[model samples]
Target: MKIYIITERARTITLEVADSTEIMHIKLQIMINEGTPIELQKIVFNEEELEENRTLKSYNIVNESTLYLFRLERQVGEADMTDERKVFETFENL
Candidate 1:
């Protein structure tokens, strides 16, 4: 079955899993990109939040079912143009 992994990290919903892998690591890594505090306890897919002890096998999830790492945080602030320019300039000089 075809399943989708809709991630909520930085709006980066990726479909990277094609086999048995620890999705928790991927979820955590993507969330870090947001550069903010994250509470894994509240992570969920659709309306059914995942539990700390729940593994992929718990749901009999196979190649058919899709997994998503959804982050439940609203992004704040906008990109400071000045900061971006400065960073770009620094990289250009190196």
Candidate 2:
């Protein structure tokens, strides 16, 4: 079956996958195709978060189903000064 995936950034892609494919596999494919880390991916279907242990068929997802992708929020305490500086520097270059 084919599924439509929409990223938080509004990027869209259609992919063909088996109904038996696990949510984790889809997450991995997103990471590979969109460069979003699998650990940071949160997929929503029918307004419910898809479970890693569950298959698309289990969620009743079928052809042409649209899944929303969101990035997991980073914890405040997990922020690093170096990462912030890098982000600023990259924007400055732009």
Candidate 3:
């Protein structure tokens, strides 16, 4: 089960090795990559927020799932998001 991870803050990307479950693996991977512990981090997926205290295994995640990491891009504003979102939305509308 290859689980994907998105480092929202650092904009770093990596794959988290599957564990008996994705519990500790999630914590360890994020901690190692970002050098921050779960207790002091904010994790989100696909524009939805996630709790760090809980385990990922319980989230009903499946194999080969594509996860996204989002963060505030410095010197950028909501305009950037709206523009990109509009493009994607427009494409789908077409």
Candidate 4:
């Protein structure tokens, strides 16, 4: 099935995935496509946050379903500063 991922920055990404695909896998795809960290990705459907361990089927997500992606902001010490900068740069480019 195809799903639409809409970022908070108003960017859109279309992806093909299986019904059994876990939310974590979707986050990974976003990571690969947008350079966003999987840990920082939050997927929401029907105004509810999707659990990483759950499958799309568990949420009854169908073809052409739209999911919102949000980047979580946190202070992860000095080691995470570069990653945070990258995420911001990605959105800035869009």
**Model 3 lDDT per residue over 30-72, tens place:** 6777665555445565565665555555565667655554343
Count of backbone collisions within predicted model 2? 0
User: What lDDT does the true structure give each of the candidates?
Assistant: 0.51, 0.91, 0.58, 0.93
Ranking by lDDT: 4, 2, 3, 1
TM-score of 4: 0.81
Residue pair clashes in candidate 2: none
Per-prediction TM-score, please?
Answer: 0.39, 0.80, 0.46, 0.81
Q: Estimate, for each residue in 1-94, the C-alpha lDDT of model 2 and write its tens digit.
A: 8999998889897889999999999999998899777778899998999999999999999999999999997677665687789989999999
User: How many backbone clashes are present in model 3?
Assistant: 0
What does the lDDT come to for candidate 3?
A: 0.58
Flag regions of model 1 displaced more than 4 Å.
1-3, 8-23, 32-46, 74-94
Residue 81 error, candidate 4, Å = 6.4
Worst-scoring 10-residue span by lDDT in model 1: 34-43
lDDT of 4 by residue, 47-93 (tens): 99999999999999999999999999855573476778998999999
Once model 4 is optimally superposed onto the true structure by TM-score, how far is the C-alpha of residue 72 displaced, in angstroms?
0.8
Clashes by residue pair, model 3: none
Model 2 residue 34 lDDT?
Answer: 90
